[model samples]
Target chain A: GAGVSQSPRYKVAKRGQDVALRCDPISGHVSLFWYQQALGQGPEFLTYFQNEAQLDKSGLPSDRFFAERPEGSVSTLKIQRTQQEDSAVYLCASSQLVEGGEPQHFGDGTRLSIL
Target chain B: AQSVTQLDSQVPVFEEAPVELRCNYSSSVSVYLFWYVQYPNQGLQLLLKYLSGSTLVKGINGFEAEFNKSQTSFHLRKPSVHISDTAEYFCAVSLDYKLSFGAGTTVTVRA
Candidate 1:
């Protein structure tokens, strides 16, 4: 795809269930970021990956959230023992440059619903 | 640390009328500012960015924004808006690699 791609546009799970979301960044993109957007709020950074290295994961709300990018091109965000508060839109973005100022291209995102 | 605040939660405008979305930021060190627009059920698209050199930045879809250092603001504006311009806009600031975003402003353009 020309742009970032995310899998499972929508997902529904009950409490205590685990969910994994996938992100396929643009070809050759060196930087990938994941964010969570709650209803009526802006997207908040969850983690960032530079190539295959997990550079920053400070924004992650808790240890239940885990993300990995072993190949630097595809990434996954997995949540364990999901709670209702974990329900939100998970967004993935990729940028060509490793620098800070470059604009990021985003995917449509996976909207998760916890029931 | 960096944070962004968008003053208006929602703004209603008529077609062909001017519209402005206010955004303010707080950061001790140098920062990069950005504006993004998200349509319903879609991802955010970059509207503009202020990295260096220029305070006034122009973006696609005829939208522009001004970076104000003293006021710590980077408000987005358009001389005229169309129905297609109706969407949610977010303002963000980056101190390092990660970005902190404001709540967001919903713009509704009525024909």
Candidate 2:
């Protein structure tokens, strides 16, 4: 089975610009999560979605960060007015069950460089 | 909120030698402990997880970790390491649906 997949593996954006990163979770996966990974650091959670509902977004650093998963399988993390500090790799993960304690499968991630 | 700490930023060990990566976590509630490995130019993959039951949990690539409640630690260890085991190891804690991660420990295995 195919694991999670993210589009535009590398994106270079100007400061103050907007960028949207897409994620395609594995088929039939019910849970999706977004995370940010800076260089030489582990990944930090950003937001999570169960189906179409965005359950957790507390990890989002600022209001400029937004995410949506309308249909359930695919999700998009949008950053408005990107800053140099937003330069990092955006990771997406999906899992089968939440309460059952299933492991989340991660995607390759999109590396965004803000110049 | 939960937080994870990896004591060592880097651990250099000779091939076929024993290695240990220390990890400690803090949380107000019960949490799930996990160890993940990331090779160069790749995303993380779960090495093992301790949700409940035995404190000693075995993971992939001959890796294992022991969950110590009193110490608030889950340190990964391998009796004999191979060169292929050289990579970044991350310790993570999850309370409810949120996941917290440590900075990560890079293990360099020298032949």
Candidate 3:
């Protein structure tokens, strides 16, 4: 992929329903990240993956949110028992290198609406 | 711990006018600073970053940011802005490998 690609640009789920968003990072990207953006707010870090290992999950809001990049190429963000407050844009970004100075390429993101 | 604060929530400027978006950060250790822009209905795009070398970093679309270590600020500035420059701008700080972002400032360029 030329850039990070996210699936299901929009999602609407009833409360308590499970939703899964997908991300296909640029080919050969070593670092993958997930973020949550609320209305009128900046993207907040959620989790990160270097290759297949989940390096940091401290920023995950709660147990309900889980992310996995099994093959280091594509990733999935799953939210269980969604709530009204869970409505937000789920952003996925990828970097060619895992180091701090590398630039990150971001996908348009999946807008999740919990009703 | 690292945190970023964007001083302005909204900035409105006439077309072809100079504009500045203020950002400040607090950190215990040396950090990398960045500016990202987000257009309506789009994801964030990196504007510029200050990694190690220069304090003044130039980015795409004629946007530039200066890293001031003494003040702990990385403010984005443009000598002249167009209506296309209207977007939400975010300042970020990275310590180690984790990145922290500011609330964001919205730039609206008017005719």
Candidate 4:
């Protein structure tokens, strides 16, 4: 892909329901990241993956937030028992280098609305 | 730990006029700085970054920023802006490959 790709550009779920968002990183990208952006706020880091290994998950807000990148190319973010506060944009980004100097390519993101 | 602070919540500029967005970061050690722009209904796009070397960094869409180590600031500037330049700007500091971002500043370029 020319850039990071995300599925289901928008989602609406009821309280207590579960939602899954998917991301397909660019070809040969070595690092993948997930972020959450609330309305009128900047994107906040949620998790990071170096290849298939999960290096950091400290940014995940709660136990209900989970992410996995089994193959290092595609990643999924799943939220269990969605709450009203969960309504926000879920973004996925990937970079070719593991170093912090390289720029991360971002996807359009999935806007989740919990009602 | 690293964190970023965007001084302005919003900035309004007319087309063909210059604009500046202020940003500051806090860290005990050396850090990587970045500026990202987000347009409506879209994802964030990298404006520029400061890793090392020259403090003046240039990026796409005629955007540039200067990284001042003394003041711990990375402010973005554009000599002339277009209506298309209206977007949300974010300042971030990278720590262990994770980015800590500021609240963001909304730039509205009017014609």
Which has the greatest lDDT? 1
- In terms of lDDT, model 2 sits at 0.93
Best by DockQ: 1
Docking class of 1: high
Q: Candidate 1: where are CA atoms >4 Å away? A: none
Considering DockQ, where higher is better, how would the candidates rank from best to worst? 1, 4, 3, 2
Candidate 4 lDDT, B1-111, residue by residue in tens: 888999999999999999999999999999999999999989999999999999999999999999999999999999999999999999999865898899999999999
TM-score of each model, paired residue for residue: 0.99, 0.97, 0.98, 0.98
Position A56, candidate 1: lDDT: 92
Q: Which run of 10 residues does model 2 chain A get worst, by summed lDDT? A: A96-105
lDDT of 2 by residue, A1-115 (tens): 5999998899999999999999999999889999999999999999999998999899899999999999998999999999999999999999988773578899989999999
lDDT by residue (A3-113, candidate 1, tens digit) is: 999999999999999999999999999999999999999999999999999999988999999999998899999999999999999999999998878888999999999
lDDT of model 2, residue A103: 84
The 10 consecutive residues of candidate 2 chain B with the worst lDDT sum are: B92-101
* Model 3 per-residue lDDT tens digits across residues B1-111: 889999999999999999999999999889999899999888899999899888899999999999999999999999999999999999999886667899999999999
Candidate 2 error regions (>4 Å): none
What are the iRMS values of all candidates?
0.8, 1.3, 1.0, 0.9
Error of 4 at A14 (Å): 0.3
Q: Which candidate would rank higher by TM-score, 2 or 4?
A: 4
The residue-by-residue lDDT of candidate 3 on A1-115, one tens digit each, is 5899999999999999999999999999999999999999999999999999999999889999999999878999999999999999999999989777788889999999999
Report, for all candidates in order, the number of backbone clashes.
0, 0, 0, 0
